[model samples]
Target: MAVPRRVVIVGAGLAGASAAGALRERGFDGEILLFGRERHRPYELPALSKEILLGNADEPAWVHDENAYADRDIRLHSATAVERVSLAGHSVLDSEGEEHRYDRLLLATGSHPRALRVPGSDLRGLHLLRTLDDSLALRTALRQAERVVVVGAGWIGCEVAAAARSHGAATTVVDPLPLPLRGSLGDEMGEVFRAVHAEQGVDWRLATAVAGFTGEDQLTGVVLTDGTEIPADMAVVGVGAAPRLGLAEQAGLILTNEVPGGGVAVDSTLRTSDPDVFAAGDIAAPDHPVHGRIRVEHWANAKDQGAHVAGNLLDAGQPYRAEPYFFTDQYELGMEYRGLADPRHDELVVRGDLGAREFIAFWLREGRVQAAMNVNWWDDGDALQALVDRHAEVDARQLRSGDLASLVP
Candidate 1:
């Protein structure tokens, strides 16, 4: 494949910034044009939930300074959204009725928060966290909120609940699952975090769904599906997010990942049905040789794929070879997870004391290490990742008692 003279990218987040950096570092010298819906520069999305919500907005979240993009001759068009991708002429139409031509196209549109659809959901005090503005607004609301009813105990919901509790607000987390993070950590391990939150005065309402909100123009309280009502001044919906693939869908690109808000299907090299069009970040469902077609919403995976896709654009010989990695932070516990293992199917094994909040867990299937997680571990993530990649048979007795570092080989 020859070098493209003009490359158009459809996202202005970390993934887009990282790709533009990679292209310049590799000495591509091409016209890299980036478009984003937000007016702000590319910043970290993970920080919006934690640091920004806690009023610690001083944290550096920008991927790079303006000088970095300017020095590389990259053109960034903020607050301009791409409406559709046309393959016939290799151009994209923007929201302002402008068309931009490109020799190569990349979609890093990322995702958006999934809104709750129930009676009274249109009321005020209902919030969804996705962008910086959403975080800022929610933070201001939490400062004055007396009681917060957090819907869905996923990562965002759990973290936001912790922040509200820190502000002396009575926090009630509602979820239909038996435990929080059950989809990722299974029942037993998920109980660990649940216990911590409970100890911190979080009212856990498991196996329950919200019937609706009760109020005229503002949320006065939340009514549960079982006819139980929880008083609240505000509610945060963190059920999950869906990929922003409207442009791809309109362009008739192949769609996969059956779940709502899934991703665009692509080959291992990140090429879509149209060879000139590619995808990266949360919007890409690249076919992994080991895990098949899966869309991972982890920050690390998106950043890595962004850089790798740039190389594929220059030379289409190499496939995306990195595995999935993710992390979560709540209260005193910090977790780093590696590999792709279904929590329901994998046999769970623990290595340290849950009481001390310091330990590592392994997800083994047929005696082969499929995935591993470290709680409160800062420097041991790479080792756990190695243990997962080795795919070696495990000795249960050794895994439970021996040092986790020894399992890497």
Candidate 2:
């Protein structure tokens, strides 16, 4: 394939920004146009839930300084939404009605928070954390809130609850799962998070569904499915997120449905059905060699996949095989998880003390490690990743008490 003279990227999030940088780094002297719906330059999303919500930082953690793009000759259009895409003509129409053509197109459109569509969902004082503005608004409300109810016990929900509790509000987390992070960590590991939050004074309403919100204008209370009403002045809904697939759908690209999370389907090269177009970040559901067709929404996936696709855009022909990785910080506990594993079916093994909340937890199927997480046990990330990459059988006893380095071979 001949090298493209121009590249257009939609979504100015981490993925798009990373791809732009990688292209320049790889000595691609082509015109790069990056469009972002948000007004701010590209920034990381992880800190919004932790540092920003906790009132530790006000500004976003920018991926690059304001002049970085101009310095690299990358044209960035902020607060400009791409309304439509013409695959046949190889052009995109922005919200401003300006049509721009491209030799190659990338859709890193990312995802948006799934709205809570129950009764009273439109009430005031109810919020969703996604953008920098959302985090700032939620933080402001948290400071004034006396009672806070967070719906969903996932990463965002848990982080928001911790932030609210830290601000001296009465915080409660509601979820249908039996425990926090049960879907990701399984019951055995989920129990550890339950203890961590319990110690931080976070109330759990597990195994229950949200019936709806009960309030006149401002959120006054959260009504559960069991007919219990938890009084609250503010509520945050963090059920999950869905990919921004409108452009992909409009362009008639293939998309996956409910198999490995659901998003625009891409092959091993991160190339969409249309060879001239590619997808990355939260929207790209790559047919991974090891994990099958999975869509990872974590920070690591966005950062790595963006660069990976840049290489493929230059005809690298290399398959994306990076292990899925993510981290979380709630209250005083911090954890990093590497690889993917189904907690329900995989056998879990621990290398440190669970009571102390400082250990490495490994999820193994048969005798090979599928995933590994370190809770407050730092400095072993590479070793843990090696264990997962090796995919070799190991003694359970050795995994629990043996040296991590010796087990890889």
Candidate 3:
């Protein structure tokens, strides 16, 4: 089954598109069928929140041209919904109720924005940024949305806040955490990001909870848990995403209870409970040899996992071994983080000035560097990533010194 002659992939996000492209590059001449719910072909999602939202780019960065797919003999079904997949029957049923048999399958079905459950969430100006359409609509609304109230201060919220400010919107980002990015970068590094927002004039309502929305047909303002009302004409919720795993679960694939999406359990090579059925991207809590069982929700992980699955499906030998990597860009700040990043750390050692906006922070546990991140720095991301890879043993002094170079193994 190394060259499974017929292959079917569901969910046409970055992962699905990358898999299809990688299969061709891997020299697989098998007949491929790809399905996407969106009308447009697979595109780069990072642009949706970054370039497109800032009006720097008009169209999404498509993963492949229609002509290119046709050139590779890949039958890509855009705007076609795959209603259900049957592992027992070895077939997938489309919305039209047509069945397609496949020797192998991949569920690249990514996550969706966790919708806000407040009363006025149904209002016209309330939004969530997840897809291309969502970003486009939000960008259009930002043009006229003064006094914008952002409900979450995560990556999406921060980016949208930055974009709204660039368009002269009075932006305010709220989050329950004391520091904006505390959930990912730890408190010390999170304060750096929080200060950046404050420096840019973004009103920070940190450690505050949203009581509810206070408008009927259209969003007018946000009500805080303590009865303080923030006047607003629009709001964006970036509370993070929950994976979409209903299809895989319905197909009897085993799932991890602790993961956000009721994550589908996959082995090192990305094969799910059923060997013929595989999972990737946001929904997969893949068991990596180095990191153990973990789920990474980022563009790079999606792309890498997609490519990894294709190679594993062909040779069945290579393990999904690439270290988890992710990046974020907020206003003038840009960063790349690598290795295992657990938010529940007791301490992090910083090597540079936060006010100056150039730094490298390391999370260490018992003298072992668990993870590292670089912000607004040049050409040092790869070297920092190497330190995490080797679990380089270094004390807090070296990490906190201009001797940042010595920390690299």
Candidate 4:
């Protein structure tokens, strides 16, 4: 048999580290080198804004230490980054002007948070939360500010608002959309989130767009599109993040189109146009088995996609297919969602009580189960997935009666 190829992975986040770990698990004796731009160990990002921000969890996010990598015989390089990629000859150039050659390369650079384009967005008190540094900076600024205005109704936006409220800061969430999580959970559930934050004493401003900033040096207030001025002590912008795809684009890789958000494109195998190069995490826009070519940014997606990339790199024989799955934790509430909703589905079945903070809603498209939302009752996730895969349709009564196991295929 031919010798195993060298594997070099970029971005040291969940995707990069998990990919390297999976490779060793699959008995790949090849030389594996993992590069991380950050000068620390790889840790989970989901807890950054929640547990880490609220001071509830203190353990490091890294699942393993340096000794683990050494034991596996994998090279883990920290405080280093791949400045550019020379696809013509499989290799990457680091920030120190050093070159490393590899037979297979995995790009998981992830993404950077999208910033506010307003004039005072660069003010000292203004902040964006995406990295550990951003979290620490925002945490400090929020403690000092008395009144805080948060822009955007996205997951991060709502989570930050909750965090700010926990710290006794007068908090307000302003979003152009009517509901905070309308993009992922649908408008109906979006209203649930709006009510949740409102009940917790957070100011929720819906269907309102920010016009401009009101300060010259530091953020003093904000201007709405209709000329409504709301004074603030500080501001946090959590709109979203733009995929870091400069290297991929420069390498002439095939770009995929994201309908609502602009993101990169890749095939089912997580491969760009260049066969040897693969991508995962936020930077990749692969065709979803159900959601078409859209990009979903969740911690689970990164871990799963990274595993797929690693499996495929072992040999040309194994190909990986991803099933979209994710979950969110806030306010002592756990919300789990599976599969993608079909745009054709207009009818929804509410099996449980949504108002009671415990319910399951299933989206149907052409008589097939497309997606589902499980609130509180987390045990039925596997049953829902099986029902979805089999396209089994049962009376809505069984779902509302807490007999979801009976609906399993």
In order, what lDDT does every prediction score? 0.87, 0.92, 0.85, 0.79
| 1-409 per-residue lDDT for model 1 (tens digits) | 6678999999988888888888888889879999999988888788888888877774438887868888889998899999888999999998899999998898999998888889999999999998888888899999999999999999999999988988889999999998999998898888999998998999999999999999889899999999999989999999999898888898888988664467899999998988888999989998877777888888898789989999887765478867788787788888888887889998888888878989888889999888888898666676677788787687877788876678667
Error of 2 at 182 (Å): 0.5
Using all chains and alpha carbons, the TM-scores for the candidates as numbered come to 0.97, 0.98, 0.96, 0.93
State the lDDT of candidate 4 residue by residue for 1-409, as single tens digits. Answer: 2434799998888888989999988889899988888877777788777876676765447746768889998898888988888899788898889898988888898888888787666777788888777787788777788899999988899888888988888998899887888877777888888888888899887889788778878889988887888889898888988878787777677776554455567777777777777888878888765556778678888888888788777655343455567777667567877777752344577877878888888877665677777888777877887876666666655656756767776
What is the Å distance of residue 248 in model 4 from its true position?
A: 0.6
User: When superposed on Cα atoms, how far off is each prediction in RMSD?
Assistant: 1.4, 1.0, 1.6, 2.2
Q: Tens-digit lDDT track for model 3 on 178-226?
A: 8888878777778888888888989999898787887778888998877
- For model 3, what is the error of residue 258's alpha carbon versus the real structure, in angstroms, after optimal superposition? 2.9
Error of model 4, residue 127, in angstroms: 1.2
* Deviation in Å, model 2, residue 14 alpha carbon: 0.4
Model 3 is weakest, by summed lDDT over 10 consecutive residues, at: 400-409
User: Whose lDDT is higher: candidate 2's or candidate 3's?
Assistant: 2
